[model samples]
Target: MKIVQISDTHLTAHGGRTQENFERVVDHVNNHLRPDLVVHSGDIVIIHPDDAADRAHARTLMAEFTAPVLVVPGNHDIGEPGAAPWAGIGVTDERVAAFESVWGTGHWRHDAGGWTVLGLNSELFGSGLGREAEQWAWIENTVADLPATARVIVFLHKPIWQVADEPTDHNLDIGESRARLLDLLGTVSLAAVGSGHLHCYRQTRRGETLEVWAPATAFVAGDGDTFAGPLHQLGIVEYDCADGTVRAGYRSVPGLDDVSATGVPEVIAAITALTDSPVG
Candidate 1:
């Protein structure tokens, strides 16, 4: 199965060149590599920006997808500190609700190409742990009931562990929210674990699981120092259900004067190359 993952397109009414770059990325995805599914890992807006309008715009963009587009909320998509109506309620709930209203609960389970795919909301304080616990229970029960040979894939908004300069948010601390799921998934012959939030990309292996983090489709966070490089990137990952393996490729759009100082298309290309491996 071919899946494209994009994240952190912080769009806003304050038009900028970055927005155009985002559109370019979108157009590229739709025109060339037609993915079976597109997974957006959040930060769809700049900051609330008239919630109604912002959300409408977000939905419209997502609707352009030729395949199913799955989304999860990001810290920016909700609101940052002192950011207005959204801030009043806490970013977690408001942002999550906004996403759910347009895209349905950012979490669920389904069958994809004979493989089980599970989406979990790891953005913290949104659905609350109790709700998460319930989802966890459901996932555990569901997986346990499935045959031992089932191939499973997991998706989330935040990387379970930090890579490079991206700090592990309190919510996604591998010791916390991700731990339960990881433990339950330990023996599941996981095809891959995909996530975003870290604008920088990285991939690793843990036993039989392949954890892949997709880069941002928007701008890259300035990492204070040692962060000088073009940042715009989008990932296309292909998974082989028959053997539980994933390979991904990426491309960088130019003319992004708003951000991305270095071209990162090679990053995407490199990740996509992993598909040749026997991950399952």
Candidate 2:
């Protein structure tokens, strides 16, 4: 099975050059790559959490793809848990509902290509919401019920850890919940884990699980300072899965190398700075 992973499109209702960049990506995937499936890791829209128009526009753009697409929520699409509200827009039931209204459920399971692919809502990992508990139960049951020999792959919006054990507040990775999720995942026939939020490409192996991070179509985040080497490059990840193993590669889209510096920093700062209270 061929899977194309794209993330962090950050489309706005008005549409701009970023959207144009994404259009090129879609055209490339359709014309050249033509993968079996497309997985959008998250942040489908720019920061307009309360605007239904933003979600609608994003949905319209995603419809252009030929292959079936699956998505999980990002901080921008449904706001982050414990994140300060931008104009009273944080991760609320209403925001999640709005996202689902356009994109279907924030989490789900699909069986394809001889692998059971699970998509989780990374924003809800420690949100303390009722939905969070419900999702946890669902995940536990889903994994528990899978056959022992079944191949499994998981996708979410944030990386579980930057370093193996140490924790950092730089991104919305699972902090307190990491151990439990890792334990749960450890019991499965895990092939790989894929995510997108850092706006860079990274691939690592922890024991048997392959950790793959897909870069944003909208922009790249860090330069060499934040993430070394080609990891900081703007690109998407392509994975070929067969039997129980997965092989992955990064594909850079032309004309997007400088777009992040030119178009995204200010908005990123504004969204990152918003919080109801300071988080330690």
Candidate 3:
């Protein structure tokens, strides 16, 4: 499937430089990439607890997505800061409610072109709030429904594993629920895992699955810091389940230029390499 992953848009009704850039990114996705399916990892808006106008604008921006956008909630959108003490609480629930009011289930699973797509809510899992059990149950049932020959692709807002020691509390470590998820995934010939909360693109080998950390569409976060301006990027990942091949590439928005000048090509190469390697 030609799947494109974009995240952390940080949109707003009050137009700003970021919103303009987001529009450009949306146009590029619609006009250029024309992906079969689009997934936004989370943080579709700049802030949580938005007013009616803000929510309406967000819905407008999301509507620009030409492909079906399977969305999840981010810390900023959902209001759950896993490590940041000052970050507000109950934001995850409210953000998810808003997302559902506009988009629908912040977490779900479906089948497309012989591949099983699973979308999970990481903010809820990290915040210890909202529909985690229900989502988990749904995931179990959905995976069970897939045929044995189908490839499984898992998408979540927060990554289950980190590429390196670049520690940030935003992503779940190899913890209990994460481990359980991995264990369940192990039963299947998992294709790849995609997540976007960290901003930087990262990849790690876990058993037979390749966990890919997708870069954000709005702003990039450095390996470990929040305040550092990481850069602006929009990314895409294409999966060929018939041959178990995956290809990833992305570009900077507004300008809609590829990031080959930076390290993005190398990231894409790494992701594709995993798809070629025998499942170990």
Question: What TM-score do all the candidates reach, one by one?
Answer: 0.74, 0.89, 0.78
Separate clash counts for every candidate: 11, 2, 2
List ranges where model 3 is wrong by over 4 Å: 49-52, 81-86, 91-95, 126-130, 163-176, 222-242, 252-280
lDDT of 3: 0.63
Give the Å error, residue 152, model 3. Answer: 1.0
Clash pairs of candidate 2? 84-275, 84-276
Give the lowest summed-lDDT range of ten residues in model 1: 80-89
**Per-residue lDDT over 1-280 for candidate 3, one digit per residue giving the tens place of the 0 to 100 score:** 7887877666666655446656787888799778888888776765444444655787788788889878776655555535452233344555568767876787777788777788877666545654677777777777677778888888877777643355544444323367777767777778788877666665566666776777665555533343333333445444445566554444544563322212333233423543565222
> For residues 1-280, what per-residue lDDT tens digits would candidate 1 score against the true structure?
7777777776654445435766777777788767777777776765442356667766776777777888776655553222232234344455556667877876777677667777766655234535456666777787787667678888776766544355432333233445666677775777788776666566677766787766766656545422344233443344444555566445555444434423334223322433343122
Per-residue C-alpha lDDT of model 2 across residues 1-280, encoded as one tens digit per residue: 8899999888877677668878989998999899998999998887656668778988999999999999999988887775543355557788788888889998999888578889999888878888899889988998899999888889999887653344344444756677888888888998999999878788888889899888888877744224554477777899999867899899977667545544565455445655433323
Model 2: lDDT to the true structure = 0.80
Give the TM-score comparing model 2 with the true structure, all chains together: 0.89
Please give the CA lDDT of all the candidate structures: 0.60, 0.80, 0.63
Model 3 per-residue lDDT at 48:
42
lDDT of 3 at 123: 62
Q: Identify the candidate with maximal lDDT.
A: 2
Q: Pick the candidate with the highest TM-score.
A: 2
Give me candidate 1's TM-score against the actual structure: 0.74
Candidate 1 vs 3: which has more TM-score: 3
